[model samples]
Target chain A: MSESLQVNTMADLMAQGKKPEVLFWVGCAGSFDDRAKKITRAFVKILNNVGVNFAILGTEESCTGDPAKRAGNEFLFQMQAMSNIQVLNGYEVKKIVTTCPHCFNTLKNEYPGLGGNYEVMHHSQFLQKLMEEGKLKIEGGEFKGKKISFHDPCYLGRANGEYEAPRNLLQELDAELVELKRCKTQGLCCGAGGAQMFKEAEPGKKEINIERMEDVEEAKPDIVAVGCPFCMTMMTDGVKTKEKEDSIKVYDLAELIAESNKL
Target chain B: MGISNIFFIIALAAAGFWFAKNLNKIIRNINLGKDIDRGDSKAERWKKMFMVAIGQSKMVKKPISGALHIAVYVGFVIINIEMLEIVIDGIFGTHRVLAEPLGSFYNILIGSFEILAFLVLISCLIFLIRRNVLKVKRFGFREMLGWPKTDANIILIVEIMLMSAFLKMNAADYVLQQRGVEHYIQAGAFPISGSLIVPLYESFSTGFLIFVERVSWWFHIIGVLLFLNYLPYSKHFHIILAFPNVFFSKLDPKGKFTNMEAVTKEVKLMFDPEADPYAAPAEPEGPVERFGAKDVQDLTWKQLMDAYSCTECGRCTEQCPAAQTGKLLSPRKIMMDTRDRLEEVGKNIAKHGADHSDGKSLLGDYILEEELWACTTCNACTEACPVMIDPLSIIMDMRRSLIMEDSKAPAEITNMLNNIENNGAPWQFSQTDRANWVNEG
Candidate 1:
């Protein structure tokens, strides 16, 4: 997992007197969680491969305060959000692409009201745009005809009403896209929304992730695809819980694209 | 005017007084919430009201229930025109006063009303069957177990009765008109009811026909008045509140959330490097209260209005991923609990003064933290609501209160917050290692 790449930070870019086309918001999970870090690397590799000029905030990048906001700590959330906003404003950043739906949702929806307005895109949307521009070429490779089920992250699907970009990008892999019983607007949460990823499951008859995984299992795909880091964690955990980790695999959409393109 | 007319006037006054008093109490209770300015884009607001409430646009998303609801809605509105004539006749003791003035137009109006009344009756009966007989899944949730189910049934039955009484009165009036009674003039059309119901009374005498007509008229008018007063107590209040709720709905993109202005201001002050040491600070908004809502009073007036306007149709709960996946959170229950808490607070204020606390709040006393934490903040509830009642906003506020005021978040979340605070992210990993995953080839 340890690989060296020329990732420029905002501070580095500012010092060099250069501006990237887009700011890559590597969210907390994508920054640290072992599995999510892979998504970050894959997304970054794709950006690097496509010759897209993108810079990370590096040590300056902080949590978007999405979990704090959703968990009811407005003070903490604002503290985090404003700190990041000041940094972005200092850099005069205009566009941001992130691999985490939580960050994507907060930066896109919750930030404008706080005077931090920018064009925020989820990595799936960004990847789709790259493909449309013919910058990111794909040859399907090993993913051709593979049975894959795409899980819609709650923030990406219902919150933002974006059910197409991720799916459209997945279709570019030339794989058999099997849909879960509950997909799109009716997509089930992987039980990590509303800061639930950071909290212990409340008393319930069954964990929400397990229930969501039931929908995934019903689709019976070789690969469970996710566009959000939180969904990746939950789905992977669900696969582990079901003891089907050896048979069923979970991959972020960026990971699949990067793997297929051998980028 | 005779003694009976005076009696009718007194009844009308009493009903009006009761309805107005209750409405005032509702307004006062809703005003208990903090003020928010929903005064922007008046034109857009009016358009939303027309499309969502008047046009029944959102309701039609689910075809069967939507169509039936539109029938009851259209019937209730159109029949009120005839109600105006009834009010005039009741006070002045004039029979069909609009009939003479409206002429053939009055006949067409009456015909439409009669048809609408029949439609209302049919729709209500179907709704009743759906609730009680067929037992629709959305309508039979645990939240709808007791009074809610009964309340829904009662409203349906009452509507059926009201429509029946209206048609019966019209039919009996037609029968008396046929008998050439002096007061029962041959005016207005009752195409369906008169043809169907008049024959049942034709064997009766003029005196009997007159008595039937008078009883049915009284029943219909009194029933309507009772229904008017009942609006505030029942879910059927949507009939009145849906318009305002839709009109005042958030006009921005559905995904956008309102940031706390106070927090934003504080953030700006913190970020500003050019601060003067001797400058007097701006006057704070009442000593900087708790960050998020803890009770009904902490919510915005629109949020409180949302509680009042919820029809409890369960479309929100039906679509909620958390609820569907057997989680504790039900968006419909959130709205209902807010309304219940608001009512409790209202009652406490009515009993004691406005500042009196009942030693309880919406948090522990009504809505539980478990339910609050169970929500995914997916906005499915907001999208599914026919009246644009945003249950997610209420849940988020309450969660805010819990975390900020009470510091009662789950242990795991507390750790995550600490991680975010210390590491600048929601993980224990150091920030320096964030970009270590990248490979140089």
Candidate 2:
């Protein structure tokens, strides 16, 4: 197998040479699920190829409490946030990064309020940086003829403004990057944030996720490129509902990068 | 007694005149803490006011308020001609050649407005109380109370007086006919003269019927004109401005402002990923302090005018989650402040020796910063303003100033922004696994 064919886990990542002073906080979205283990490992390896040598600061990781805050449970939100902040501050970590938009949103947008201010960057942004620096080498132009569409996570796009990095990386992969009108600033919420991710969505005329997923259908792509893990999960469910699960694929931006290696 | 009667008549007449005039002046004052930066021309103000105020356009949205307001507005306008007869009869005697058509039409309108104005007034009072009273009954009223309560209240009194005038005129006719002297003065210089003032008219006559009619006429006519002239100065001003505000409403989509004055980082980044994220954002920027309205004066003149224009309808407060759930938010207060400020400023400006030669004015202290920040930018208040005052815009600019420049906001929200700058998510997540959600979730 090619050296790049094999991926490394967070344990292996630290065992390898570390270049930067940072701790990667694995969010509940990743820590809680096993499939997330697969995509995250892929992202970790992609990060290595990209020159990020930070150790996983998983020990200090805690829920950002955005879900509680947005759920109108202010007290619970404060409790969760304060505890997370104490641990993060105790680890004395200065910078952070994450894949879950919820974690990203809370850490970057919600946590600093609780006194855990740290430099946060989405994994997509970090990877896009690697691609630009020629650290994450690409091999396959095979998907050149295939069509792809990018699903912008609501927090990272409309909320935080990290809309383009993932799509630019995709375009470099030589896939036809189709655009959706509701893609960026006007990006529709996946009905998963503001704690909607955990609780039953307050009933409305139509489900927000369903509304967003329908917007995705119009792009008519062979694959839907996504950045945040929640978006991948949500859009995957959307793809299943439309029963286009097989024909249409949801690839995390990192997964796309890994798949692009053409090994 | 007749001497005292004349004095009674003059005193009521003088007070009514003063009240109406002062109302015009007062409605033009009350600072709303917005920035109505004399940017638009008189023509623009007139254009907005004409289409919005004179047009009675906004009310059309609330099928009930709009339809009722339209009827009341039309009735009020037609009642304008009706007032001409009352004033002429009060100051002099007889309604002149104009009284012929007005007499019959006034009766016809009694039924329309007697029923309609009463409903609008009662409904509006329910709203007025809803905004301040803090109750549940306000729920059913669609929260209609507002500064226009001034208009509606006056309208109610006017309707009652106008209705009474119709009733009194007919009752006098009844008294005169019963006394057997319809031929003596039906169209004479004294429509309700000596013989017409029989025992029935006498008891009521001893009271200031003429004086009351005169006061009511002044209230009706003066209220209409001053309200008209002050149309751009108040919240019910929307009852006038709504048509225009709606017509010019940012038809693009909900949640987008009218103008996209500059490119965002996404565009800049697309063009040059090397660009700094802190670069200035586009839209109404050069002299403007923030993206959202920084203060009351920051509001468009139409919005400043919307305070006066607001009918005091509490729909905005009713639908507002923060307000509904007991947060210290009231859309009516914001709208009222605009008119209130203008009225106050108008008084100061019109004061005998005030100093505003440079016109470098602040909206003063009408809206509290706390009030400004309390807004959730939910747009419900704007949606319910009846006049289309878009209070959210005023608030957003203030937020922009506080957040972008002053770095001010609730410590919680600011902390979130700090979390954003520090952590990839609002949590203390591992940066390496930002993509972990893809694999795990």
Candidate 3:
């Protein structure tokens, strides 16, 4: 838990006559899912430690309507997208960073068409940029030789074609990076995309996450690194299905970085 | 004019009539979809057509198959030059009509046609081997088992036969010229086929050689006419529809989904505090329509065009994460089902009146809800399609119908939607507790 950190909101920052370099869109999963909240804290810790001024939409932030849109509720999606766009336009937000690929994808890709344009970057991309600028120093420590296999969230990998930033950030941890047979453009989904995270999977031979978990098992890594909160939930559930939760671990890229640096 | 000329003209008229009737039926079926404005960006649309459909730019993404496809495609177009001359000769009782005035240039054109026919034969052979012998995984998917597989093989065999007929005609004609036969003028050149088939024809009498040439010539022209009419019934319709499909493809940034204009209006009303309260309510556009597509008629005309244009190469399904991970969803199937349903609706309209309702639709009966839910909305299907057929658009439209029209989302999804409505997010937490993670250090 990040008890000592004083997180600023866009409203608070504006009231203080200050503006952040980027607005952190803490998605629903990041803000409320118990497991994903750890990822949120870890990402914030990195931002604070690196001295990058960022603020969240905080109480004003809502779902980007990704699930709603994917689930086919155009009315709900518009209602949600327009609300966020209004708040963003009110603050004149020019840049955004989020830990969840769903929010990152919707805000970066979907928002522009709805007149909510912003320079959106996933936290992994933002972290890589920080590392390139020599602003964030990473000590690999315990994770130096550990095997880590990254599970590319569909929105980040296939949808956006961003296969390198997260991997590049992981390389900073000095971990033994392993490639899953199906990776990058060929990566399997964690079965939580297209608003699947909010629904029980329909009848099928086997659950998709379980099928994806087989790829993780084949990689045989110590850590199953993920970028999206939805992926975090699905992969975590997958590991539980394999009964390997005790030996294998599911982590966000930021969490791994935070752990390595002993933050 | 000779009696042969009269028969040839009658045959040409019959083929033309058959082709026109089928073409009209296809147009009527595609027009059954709701109208959408794809007329914007004329310049950009032309560029897309030229680049994607004409240049086969997207096809070249996978080099081996791409190269073979281009060979067949280029051959199909280039060989049509000979068809034009045949058409002119068939009606006017003139043999090699362009050859006399054009002379050496006509020889050059025939030489190129011979070379292209050979290429077409070879390309079709290789495509057959890839589809049947090599058994490419994409081609052998579950949905491709019946007519799709048969359709692919049939088109390839027809191409091979057409190319063979062309070469055989050239061969016999070359022998006739060697014999200095009257009415068999040495006009057009057959560079490759002439040399290759000369030995086989040398043993035949002049009359027999003329008979072979005549039969092959008639078969070649009639085969082409048959192929044209068959286009409406086969996935090979891409030969005609791909150009227009590429031209009218969604040109926005690929990741952007279309926002509902009706929803956009409602959102604007909610956002504006100064909105007129006493103003006349917006006029209802006829009857209230469902948000997304449930039947073929609910889709946009371009989407219907996309269905017609699908090559069924299964590249989209091959790239689909859901299909790879053992889900029921196949993007290729989505396009196929849409085409099938559209055909059904078209047939129904043809049998009954235009206003007839069969009570069947694209959704549930053809495409299952389970399959629609499996898509990750990853756009992999759209990205992988060589001709820009967007299965995701159809999938999303169906999903919209399921959710907005029927309110029949999965229970968990309903719960999440409820959370979003009540908590402003997709979880049970209050908006005030959204930043609680900041205090957890």
Candidate 4:
């Protein structure tokens, strides 16, 4: 599925004096986590099908230092951020799109303070923009009339004030988009933000993701769509914990859209 | 001037002096925190202050509570305008001084105040029931025990008494005026008091009605003065600080954790090739700067003000994922603890000198490491705060102190931080393998 993919490195594109319209920042999770990597491929497939000009930083990209920053290690966060800024500025990158909300948040909001300014968008926003521009066409396909629920990523929804793009994209897929009880500004966390993804949750009556899954069960959607890799991991685990993985599915927004487009 | 007039002056003077002294101490306690400039945006701040504080905009997010609260809040503020007349009447030994000059306008003002006071009384009764009988989930959290619970009830009870006294005073005055008694002018309208309450006083003697009017008037004024003095000690302090707290709210995106400039300088120095490695430091080293907050004194002044401004409404804790799912980290508790610790520190300083130590700090003594680690940093608490308090920032600051200063973090967090430093990502994968997903078949 992935071998025939055509991807350009920022270095290669710069060598040819050709700049892509956007830099696809494949974040740490999108690059390394096997499950998130598929979401990355799915988004890339849609991008390729639409023929939107985009390039990846490939090995030149490192962690955006989001986890370290969130975990209260400002020294390490700045070290990573300063290096990334140097590399980004060297490329004269003007725009960025990422599948990860953490990367999108860090690069878009936290980077400018450290002198790495760019127009950054989450892939859902980017895809929604492409649809708005009449460049990308999505048919209902398998998603027609299917009950889908979107788990809002904290960084995307509350953190960045973006609650529309992913939902708009889902609407384009012709899915019966239902909302979880706590959504938008009141959305529950997947228990994976603030570096909690890499650690066990503190002792509690229930895991945060389990609590979120209860909301999902109340909505009773056939599939849970997530815009964040952390949310994806937690929701997938949540579905497993409920022992309903076979009956219910959790898919990233890009993956769902890609399947709908048959990319 | 008469003896009662002098006594009223003495009461007013004493209340004003104590209130001023307490306000000065509060200012000093808040200033003990590190300063940050939230003065960058003046126009935007004023707009927010008017909208959120003056307009009570955000409170309306929860319709029932919001409407009830606005009734009480508006009643309290609007009724206080009557205090001006009360002071003049008490000091000059006059009755309704604005009555003759303002004419029927005074009637409209008093009539509206009477209606508002009735609403306020009703709202306070309902709030008491919500807190005690129905046990609203937010108000019943573990942190709302003891004084916190009693503080809310006391304020409501006090407000109920104050409004009742106001209506009774109007009702008695109306009855005396109807009887054409000496010095009881028919000045202001009393829609609620005159219609509902005056009948109860109608059968009383004119002399007895005069006694009721005088006693009610004195009680109302003294209650208002006592409430004023009580502001600094109670979470009711929010009534005054909410304006400034909302005005200085974080204007940036909620996700943007502040970039530490001190860390940036050090990182820049490390990366600078042209700089001398062995050069003497440019500035003489001052007291070692703590990386993040260990106590209220280490927090920003705005944060300390946030502590003061918290209504202990539990709105933040209600929205917190950890608290909702039974984690020890109640965002409301965080603010309450900060305020409680600040008060302790302020008292210690008052007893001893400015540098006095309480032998306890906000972090270990008040806020537990377990609670600090429980936050997901989702900003729901900040979003849910009607006055825009950022308890998440305080949690993050304390987390920073725990990790960077004390090197005391959950083992998993230490591992995660180490991985990010060593392997670029917050996992053990090599940086060389970052692009391996591209060619995976």
* The best candidate in terms of DockQ: 4
Error of 2 at B176 (Å): 3.9
Alpha-carbon local distance difference test for all models: 0.87, 0.55, 0.88, 0.92
Candidate 1 chain B weakest lDDT stretch, 10 residues:
B432-441
Residue pairs in candidate 4 whose N, alpha carbon or C atoms collide under 3 angstroms: none
TM-score of each: 0.92, 0.46, 0.90, 0.98
lDDT of 1 by residue, B1-441 (tens): 899899899989999999999999889888988888899999999998999989988899899999999999999889999989999999999999899888899999999999999999999999999988998999987888898998898899999998898888898899888778898888989888878998888898888878888898999899999989999999888888999999988886555666887777776777778876578987876657767888899999999999999879999999887787777889999899899999999998889988798799888888888899888787778878999999998898888888877889788889989988898877687878766665423
**Backbone atom clashes (below 3 Å) for every candidate:** 5, 103, 6, 0
Highest lDDT: give the candidate number.
Answer: 4
Q: Give candidate 2 misplaced runs (Cα > 4 Å).
A: A1-263, B1-74, B84-159, B173-252, B258-294, B341-374, B419-435
User: For each candidate, what's the DockQ?
Assistant: 0.56, 0.04, 0.56, 0.82
Tens digit of per-residue lDDT, candidate 3, span B31-135:
988888889999999999899999999899899989988888988898887788899988888888888889899998999989988988999999999988999
Model 2 C-alpha lDDT per residue in residues B359-384, reported as the tens digit of each score: 43222255555555444333446545
Off by over 4 Å in 1: A1-6, A137-149, A171-181, A217-224, A240-249, A259-262, B265-288
lDDT of 3 at A11: 99
Best by TM-score: 4
Docking class of 4: high
Docking class of predicted structure 1: medium
Candidates 3 and 4: which is better by TM-score?
4
Q: CA shift at B338, candidate 1, in angstroms?
A: 2.1
Tell me the TM-score that candidate 4 gets on chain A alone: 0.98
